[model samples]
Target: MTEMLQFDFMRIALVMAVLIGLTAPAVGTFVVQRRLSLLGDGVGHIALTGIGLGLLTGSSPVLGALVVAVLGAVAIEVLRARSRSGADVALALLFYGGLAGGVILTNAQGGGSSLQSYLFGSISSVSASDLYVVAALAVVVLGIVAVFGRELFLLCQDEEVARAAGLPVRFLSVLIAVTAAVTVVIAMRAIGLLLVSALMIVPVAAAQQVTRGFRSTMLLAMGAGVLSAVSGLAASFEYDLPPGPSIVLLALALFLAAAAGGTVVRRRRARRAGEVVPGPAGPGERPRVDAEAEVISG
Candidate 1:
């Protein structure tokens, strides 16, 4: 088992995992706060259309996917601008549209194998070239995230307030969406269209469970994502599981562990302060708060 870890395949997976770990949550933080977890799903599936087009034209699939994903993001913004309904409807339309386009194009061009890779992902088939592409995508993703960190936070906290404060909300929103599309494209290499959304959702969700502050949550989420990537890649190599699903499950396990630890700490502190109630929580029963009394008593 130890000897297996030193192989080139494992090494490539590790490098790819590191690149994915850093960018997934960085972009994911915004995606989560935007209430657009499905955005990744929508854009990722749409990316297949781009890959199909690329395969037909003998272009790079990654670049093609990136282009298609960005177009999808732009289309989303345009749709939101003109509509009164929620973004969910827009997402559904885009996803379905892209999926149909991809299927048709692939069938027409006789490139089912190439399209299959984009649709289902073939992480185990990753080559050194794929790693290089992912590394480049990581840099691009991180650059965009860093450049707009403040704007993203503003949007997340309160978009209306940000607009009132002259934060260019529309442009920022489009920028964030585009960044998410790019992240999804990069992650698709390892996780596939079916599961790439997990990379954006799991780590940040877990981090938010433990951290109240935004900075803390982002940092913790990034750490958790990196850990999951490393552990999951190792698991896939050792246990012959799929990489993307393994990473997601590892992340979920971490979340459960964190939740348990948080619960224990909160309860212990409450008990130590003699705040334990005599009976169990009732239906819609609120804890009787004696804030001033408790403070004085302490």
Candidate 2:
């Protein structure tokens, strides 16, 4: 760790990784609660087209990605608000379309090069300018979440209730979507588009196993993500592996450990209480699934 810091680019990657690790999970907590986790992937796919265009034009791909990602978020919200198909369907359409367009454009302009770096990741690929752009965006994302914390929590709990209580669901929804887009762009630098959502999600999923408050989960997830980033980089440097995948693998291990630990704790608590405990939850299930259902029904 000390030796890697000697290089300027390594320092930049480390700083950017910490920023992305902290930021992704902060926003992801709300995203997971609202079941829009896949939105990250959809927006990333759309951002690819812009990244390709940027490469072709010899401009900053990150800027191109940010612009396209915001537009993708807008398109998603508009489609979602239209009552056309379900939210998942709308995201799926965008995901495929964006990927297809990105592939075509990139292939036409630049022989479809560097797709792997965009899809996977190369921490060394980030430059000082990339660091600045990501840092600025990270601040904006964190600020928005901080300022609208209450309203966003409400939106997570129930969009309709938030709307009924005059919380500006439409505006908040757009705000959150755009914020998520920014998160995706930042994450793309560390983990790449294909696995960026994992950074946003897996740590939060691990934190959820402990059953604290929503805010606690978010905090825990941030800690977990930072740990994963640092440790993953360490492992990659030691073993000559890819940084992003290594980080994601560590996060998965954490998630599994948390799930197993939570199961053991829950069973013990049930035994002490002299009540039969429910079976362990499936991978697909999340915390407050029943409450969210009630909110939906009501």
Candidate 3:
């Protein structure tokens, strides 16, 4: 690690990774709670259009992506709130339209080759300016999370309940969407637009495997995200691999490990309680319903 950090680029990459690690999961906690796990991907797709626009206009791709992504996120939330039936259709349209626009714009600018880097990620290429932007955006994300964490949690747990409790549901919803958009843009350089959602989501899922409360899951998810990002960045450096995929794969591995461990712990608890632990469910059978209920109840 020390050897890797000796280079200026490596140091920048490391800082970017850590910042991304910390912020992605913070927003992801709410995303997962609302079961909108694919929201990041959708916003990322839109951000790609912004990137293409930046490249075509010879402007800053990050700034362009931020603008487009925030607008797209707000549009999505408004549409979702207004018409539940067409939400999926609206998202699909944005997803495909943004992707197509990005490809066309990028190719038009002869930036086709450069698009791959944004699509997958190239942490080594992260510049000092990019780091500054990422840091600023990350601070915004964390600040919003810190100040509105409980309200967001309530909003995610149940929108109806949140509304009944006199929370500003519409405003809070928009804020969450906008926050997620910023997070996607912040992570785009280090993690890539296509794979950024994995960083946002997988750690939270992994954390959920062992945690029972919202706060615990959020905290653990951030820890898991940081560990995955740092370790994956180091591994990629040592192995001459892609940093984005390596980080996402490591996060997935952690999820699998956590799932296995949680299962083992649950089974042991069940045994001590003299409950019968059933095996895998048969075809068309719902498995572990009783066991899950026991775990939840306990």
Candidate 4:
């Protein structure tokens, strides 16, 4: 523990944690809002294939990941346009195909470096160079989101409406796709490619379950993500476990906590309002069921 606090590598890892935690939720808010969460999973895995190709070519893994990540995003859009199965099926195909290709490439080279670390993650090994890349990527992602946030939100809420409002929805969609690719690439060093998508989606998913508005939800999700990243890294150090999976697990735990917390708050409010018992409906009233209870019962 003492070593972690004083060590430079640990500091870099922590910096990465903060950078990713902040921006991922911002991007993820759009992802979740648009119901495109699976894209994160697809792009992250595709990035692994890029890294494998990079290794084979002795190129920068970051660049390789970026190339494939963006390509995967574009491919998804294209596939969505051409197919009835839409984005989910496209995502599935890209994800598994990329993983299989990467594994084949790694195996062909006799598999010296275990790809599991890239799949699961190990933040303890983060270097200053990786931190630099992450910081740059975070800045770029945040900048794009900030400048075009309004349009992005409009598009996300209702693309046809955004188009009617003359918001250039197509351009914004492409911008988001590219930004997501870059974000995945930036995050790969800290969380690895396979599990990095969780960092993007889990916090936002949790926040949406509790928060009322888009802006508040995004902020809360970012906070949740940062907390998860830092605490998970700390726990990994203390337990001598893999950092990436630990961080993702921590984020998952936060999601569960937020859901439980939201439920408790709702019940408390209902009790305070003295609305626990149902009143008889008026003559015209049919029946109404609580959505939560229905989900639970089903």
Highest TM-score model number: 3
Pairs with backbone N, CA or C atoms under 3 Å apart (clashes), candidate 1: none
lDDT (tens digit, per residue) of candidate 1 on 1-298: 4765678877787888888888998889888988888888888878878877876788887788889989998888778666767766766878998989878887888877756656655556788998888898889989987888988998988899999999998889898888888888888877777778788888898888777578788888889989998888788777878777888899899889888877877677678657444345444545434443465467
In model 4, which range of ten residues has the least summed lDDT?
Answer: 287-296
- TM-score, one value per model: 0.84, 0.87, 0.90, 0.86
What's the lDDT of the predicted structure labeled candidate 3? 0.91
Q: Model 2, residue 195: displacement in angstroms?
A: 0.7
TM-score of candidate 3 on Cα atoms, chains taken together: 0.90
Tens-digit per-residue lDDT, 90-176, candidate 3: 889998899899988888988877798899888777899999999999999999999999999999999999999999999999999
Please give the CA lDDT of all the candidate structures: 0.81, 0.86, 0.91, 0.81
Better of 2 and 3 by lDDT: 3
Q: In angstroms, give how far residue 240 of model 2 lies from its true place.
A: 1.7
lDDT-best of 3 and 4: 3
lDDT of 2: 0.86
**Candidate 3 collision pairs:** none
TM-score of 4: 0.86
- For model 2, how does the per-residue alpha-carbon lDDT over 66-166 read when each residue is reduced to its tens digit? 98999999989888878755866767888888888777877877654478788888877788998989999999999998999899999999988898899
Q: Which regions of candidate 2 fall more than 4 Å away from where they truly are?
A: 84-88, 271-298
